[model samples]
Target: MISISETSTQRLRALAAATAAALLLAGCGTAEDDAPTDTDVSASPSAISLPVTPVTIELVDPGAEPRSSLTYEPAGEQSVVLTTSSTVSQQIDDQAAQDFSTPEITLPLTAQAPESDAGGEIRLRIGTPTSADQRLTEALAVAEGSEAGLTVTDTGAVTALSISPNADAEDAARAAIEQALNQAVYRSISFPSEDVGVGAVWTTEQQVVSGLTLNQTTTATLRERDGDRLTIDLRIDQTPESATLELPDDAGQLAIDTYTMSGSGTLEFDLGRSLPVSGEVTVAGEQQYSDPEGTTVLRQDISDTLRWSTP
Candidate 1:
């Protein structure tokens, strides 16, 4: 058995609350100044609509000759099985590392295009998620048969997203599902307007507000192309927008001393499909925060992998 002092217990609770709030806002895709404090998952899909932020992709090099537009061509109905897994480790101050890792989660989804092509809407229905962890399985029980609606452009830009979660779901579970959907819908590579062949290079910039505001940049290079299938390499970097972070509920403020995050990965995309074929990304960072109690250092490691297959 483990025992925690009263003061430590209070600190842990505050940390838990702050972490939860951060995760909920991370998926908003809005700037830090405009992000909402809380997300309403029980509301109607339209009422819970997420702000649409345009991703700007600038081409640095067109690469070799034989360049062609990489665009999505929606065909008939499609079904895909996505296997995703993530691990997170966080250490605060001099305490032991905390294990917040998530077991491998397998989600089967179906995508259908709208009858009219005017709006370019795609409706996705997410089936039940399977996980080896009993706690995660219980938390995701209400997520079964949830749906996500997205409006995307031919260049793989997701203009709008709406998620509908079960009304009876817990706040933490609902937030987790929403965050997962947000990443699944928006993390795909958005092709540039200009055509490019193998070795093409481009970069995209976006802002994200988790616990702290971060400017995220991704550089992508086309490694190979075969018909509608393409393999791309991705490098991601993140920087804090400010040095001070105000914790929710007036818990306390943290003055960031130093922060660094960077990662690299590869993705396989098919223009004929609604989602990526396979991909994996990993990010690790460390930061020092100071408060009235004292200075605390946090180190985090996070990773996610995706696998898709036609049913």
Candidate 2:
């Protein structure tokens, strides 16, 4: 008879829970807002705590002449919808690989800004996610009425974040939502401090931790500009910070043999709104993990889109 340690069982459960959440919620980016209204509530303390990493933005090109400063100003109550879809495949040892794809998911959200003039804080209320796939819909039903709060700078840098799951949400559901939200926050763009015009180019560098610690770098180019509205192109790349990863609950350590992740997308942004007007990002990567038991390989392909329309 084969026996598994209690710690190994716990780690397996955690991995399973994360996998379930990834199926229902897979995407990136934030939504738009409406008009400005006074928000009397103070910034809530951050519920998700992770090590802070400084984000550095460097301007490569200011674009053609007639450049101007780009900034974010709080717009009052607004409504927008977000949609996402993804596919993942995995194989272990000599086992046959499997592929899974999720139906398109649509999420409606409302964003509110604080009363302060600095306009550094924004609160978001997310409605239930729905999908045409009955199986996915049934799974997402438990996350109805989830809420997320974020603190961002004028340049759109996310500093702090929190997620409030529904009271009846299961542990797996909560884990999935948190993972999705974290991706959205880290994938958000931060602008350069200098003035820029159409054709402007810049790069942002930071470190992010989800299941693995990664060095994330994004390069953005200004594609178009019409007064307060702008279109930007983005390219993202990620690499592991180290070659070895320690499993949770002391399940064991795995040596990372190969890791690569990259994506490209475009974002429509408005300075007057709290979030992007519309955007789509597609990412694909393959990673190999090795342990005494053998080798496991995971390959994931993800595509996310965010759309905003006035309510």
Candidate 3:
């Protein structure tokens, strides 16, 4: 029989490759000079009304980028496309008082994926600046641990990312902080269009491959304007899919079986802040795999929520 340890090692490497590909992005903010400012909104005490005509989605906001850890080529065809769907919601409480002076933000997040795949429904709460730095420190520890089979470090990046940058943290701590900082910077997508009016539609597509043979075609439509907020509808056409496996050294001819997956959701972007307030998405599908061992089946019925708020 194949060594279980070897199999685990190979599987982890494959998953890591797939993850990196799916989370492709450029670097993010690091210097104290990179702090974010509240542009595109009203400075007055009262809330401002929605903008007229077309509106654009800012992709380079200092503090509003999504975070990622892994890095790889975009997913491609003749590979697996791992699909992800999200349903995020946001609400503003006018009655509750909040301090606008702080740069901190708390975002609630959830995710679900198949076991054979590299995903499971995970519920996580993330806070910006310090909390974000701390979480990265923990993850970095795992990645650099002797048993973690790693040999990389970036402690300085962690210090730079912290609300209180600490250049003195250990190598593992810094590496983790940098990793977290990278992800946050990547989330801030740079979209085009000066103004997107009601009924206007936009699409974001990538020809790069992250690992899986798949599509990431997404369409967003300006659905409605309810006073201070704008509702946007979204549809995902493909997900990242790819697999790295270790077959018997002398294994013969091989065959692969694939399946179908699809999903839809909505995003609530605040007209005032021009940021996604909240939204929800649901995705369902089934997949099958086979080999000399016989056959294996996988099914996915996953849903998730994303919310953003501040006072």
The lDDT leader among the candidates is 1
User: For each candidate, how many residue pairs have backbone atoms clashing (under 3 Å)?
Assistant: 0, 3, 45
In candidate 1, the residue pairs with backbone N, CA or C atoms under 3 Å apart (3 or more residues apart, or in different chains) clash, namely none
User: lDDT by residue for model 2 over 1-311, one digit each (tens)?
Assistant: 11244554445335433332222223211111111123323432213332235689999999998999997775787676666555555544445555544455666778787568644667778778777677666767887877777778778888866565666766545544555555566567888999998899999998765445678889999999999898999898877888866555455666767776778888888878777778777666666666545434333333443334444
lDDT of 2: 0.63
Model 2, position 229, has a per-residue lDDT of: 90
lDDT of 1 at 288: 56
lDDT of each: 0.65, 0.63, 0.31
Q: lDDT tens digits, residues 188-287, model 3?
A: 2223333444565566553223223344455666567555465767665554344422222342211224444445677664423322356544433333
Q: Score every model by TM-score.
A: 0.81, 0.78, 0.39
Error of 1 at 302 (Å): 3.6
- Cα RMSD of all models vs. native, in order, equals 4.7, 6.6, 19.2
Which sections of candidate 1 miss by over 4 Å? Answer: 1-47, 114-118, 168-173, 292-299, 306-311
lDDT of model 1 at position 62: 94
* Candidate 1: tens digits of C-alpha lDDT, residues 52-132: 567788999998999999878766677777665556566666677776655666667788765555487687777886666
